[model samples]
Target: MEDPNPCERAKKWLQSLQKIENMNKIDPREAPISLDSSNIYEGFVFRGLQIDQLQEGRALCTFKVPPRLVDGNGIWPARVIMSLVDNVCAAAIMTCDKPVKVSVDYNLSYFSTAKTHDEIEIDARVLGHKGGLSTVVVDMRNKITGQLVAQARQSMHNLGGLTVTPRSKM
Candidate 1:
């Protein structure tokens, strides 16, 4: 059954994420497999992501660049970096007491290269909200050297008074 209260749903989702973060090793047999693009991307990008802190309108996370995400030059690809920024920003936005919003505008800047096995720290914070739009900024930095890797600013639009239903299985 679907939870009617968005807050409760959000809380449950966050708790599940926290639980996953605390696990030392995830059993492959217990892992869920889905054809959903969002789930697939999340599973791939967040395999080594660790949630260090979470609060209202803020999130701090750490991730190690995996080999699968590296390009031929042995550095993180732009798409991977962008995906990390977008997902982290969305996680920060989810900390707020509002329904999930869809990204309408996303601006990203890459500053440095990240190689495989490089640890990156991610910090995301909600800038503000206007009417149905919320803005957030995410910063990625080298955990060891503190060099900035990338930054992203995204604006998300909330669909007020709209009921969103899940797509049924075909």
Candidate 2:
């Protein structure tokens, strides 16, 4: 059953994220990017997503596979998976409190396909860091059976000192 209290849900999610960050020794300043209506995560939220887990170099997002994102044969398309990879990779990087990065390269491999309305989980992690580049790996799976759906590797270029933030809080 779902928790009726938004506060309770937020608390549980925060605790999980905190535990993972502590275990991995991630920077305290890093935080999970929210699914604001104006953000890309809003797309996932519109499709019925739930943040299952998150931490430095790792994240677990669960959602019901929407038929609209699938092909005629009911197979989840590569494009959608690619977008997921990009977003999850960004989330993984967001755990570091570093400057925003832009994806320069993405290598994705598909192992299987998911059906419409399937409960699936996408897990992503920062695999390594070198100089101004970051490498991330992502995997999609069946939430119920833990079957692999797809795997992806993405590399992003850190903008570093070139990044610009809002002048003040909203």
Candidate 3:
């Protein structure tokens, strides 16, 4: 069963991210990133992602391709894969004591396809952080076969001083 309170869950997620930063001995001068639990779209997209490990500027997760995300051909679509890559990369970046950043550039390569219910291992690592920009590389592989499904390199920029307000439900 899902948690009844979204804010509570968000708090736990934030704590976990902070723990990773602390474990890595991140500079105390840097500000920690905050999660917006009210972002329902992100919540939906990241629904079943299970974090297997987290460290400073890196994250590992496991996921199973769900039926709802598969196309009529029983393969996961490119769009969904892109969404997963983007969000997972962001989560990995957040572990490094940085404020929320928006993707400014993205490059993705698809090597193989994942079918419905296929177990996948996702690994994301931040390559660098310079000024207000951060870059991350992500790889998705089939758990059993170890075949690469997709790889993504993403660049994100901090939206300095800008506060994002959640949209009101229609």
Candidate 4:
């Protein structure tokens, strides 16, 4: 009562600091990701693709496509579709920590096409993870019709990348 133990005081201080950090940190569990309005994905009202469930080393991510995500060919660009898929696959690998790894190889398939206003769902699973390489399965679908528009696999290297570098002209 007269004097607190130095060790006990240090531990209590640490716990309080941790609680404050948790309160200040973003809770992706309850809220949408906070992307700046000027971000590329935000350029078109990007929606959150979240992992709704997981089992047996696999996870499922459900997404509702926005009305504005489109491409030049007038078809939903494979790149955009892949972007959603990548988010899901990486999210699975990142089930623990987002800073753990980056996507390296992403393979996709387009069984059908979508209009600019069409809604899509992306489902992904983990095939395996070895030596810093993660293999995942992803599927794209029409949100309303429930049609399977695409099935694909994504491979990601364990290296971490906050953003991928775009290819440039030679």
Candidate 5:
């Protein structure tokens, strides 16, 4: 007999959550993110990212630095950290079913480097939101020594289902 797929199970759980009419009233942390990209791009970029825990506007995100993502010096690049931070920021500010938001402004500060095979944990929190914009802060730390690796402050604008400009095909 074949063992059941955990990914399939997770999708089913997310589906059940979507069925609830009061999904927005439920604690945002309680929502399980789906892995399907057709449903959301956050899931696609965060394919291997894990949400260890969350509360209110804060989330604990974990990711492993794969060998393929390392730069020439065998360290993860700042751009990678920025991408992860942006996603984590979105996760911190929005709940399931909330309209997707795009990063309008983002900034990063690197305190250290992460080598291939390093396990990283990010603490992301939504600082505030006004009108159509939300401000988020994230601190990336090494899970092993708990040293700070990078930090980011991002501003996002809620697009509210408005179509986005598509990137030109290469």
Candidate 6:
């Protein structure tokens, strides 16, 4: 379920944004970003991220893999991994306040691996954004299994303006 009142949500965003801005180092372009998970979707909350820090074009998130995220054969679904990576990657570069964005390309490299009920951590960094294009990289690894299920680098295009909207799981 989502908190649908834009007015109330905006108030919460401003309050939290101000707090983060006051105590943390941030960039000018990131002023409007909100770290509160209330803005994030519930599907992502299935794995749930433990966000340690948020900086302009940078973020660190940790996920505790649950058995529900596993497929019937006892393997983590590639879609699940991809979704996790996508959420962090998008959020990492999101606050530039661009109204519209489209994923131009995404490249992922799988190293070790992740299993059911494992805690995975990912670090995402924005590489660059020129014109309307933005590029970012994410490093993902299973904390307990010490396996790297996948890492992805993506390019996105900021469409026209920034409009924060709830995205349902695809």
Best by lDDT: 3
lDDT of 3 by residue, 110-162 (tens): 99999999999999999999999999999999999999999999999997988
Q: Write the per-residue lDDT of candidate 6 for residues 73-144, one digit (tens) a residue.
A: 777777777766665666677544432257879898877656767778888888988998888899888776
Give candidate 5 misplaced runs (Cα > 4 Å): 1-45, 96-98, 163-170
Worst 10 residues of 5 by lDDT: 14-23
lDDT measured at residue 116 in model 4 versus the true structure, 0 to 100: 64
* Pairs clashing within candidate 5: none
lDDT values of the candidates? 0.76, 0.68, 0.76, 0.57, 0.69, 0.64
CA displacement after TM-score superposition, residue 33 of candidate 4 (Å) = 9.2
Q: Considering summed lDDT, which 10 consecutive residues are worst modelled in model 6?
A: 14-23
lDDT of 2 by residue, 1-170 (tens): 76334333333433433233222343446534433333333343334556776665676788688877788999777777776667667767766544447898999998888889888888888888888898988888898888998898999988765865659665
Tens digit of lDDT per residue, candidate 5, span 45-132? 3446666765567767788887766889999887767767876677666542233478999889899999988999998877888888
Error of 3 at 12 (Å): 4.2
| True-structure lDDT of candidate 4 | 0.57
**Candidates in order: C-alpha RMSD to true structure:** 6.5, 11.5, 11.5, 11.4, 11.0, 11.5
- Better structure of 4 and 6 per TM-score: 6
Q: Rate residue 164 of model 1 by lDDT.
A: 76
**Of the candidates numbered 2 and 6, which has the greater lDDT value?**
2
Residue 118 accuracy (lDDT) in model 5: 92
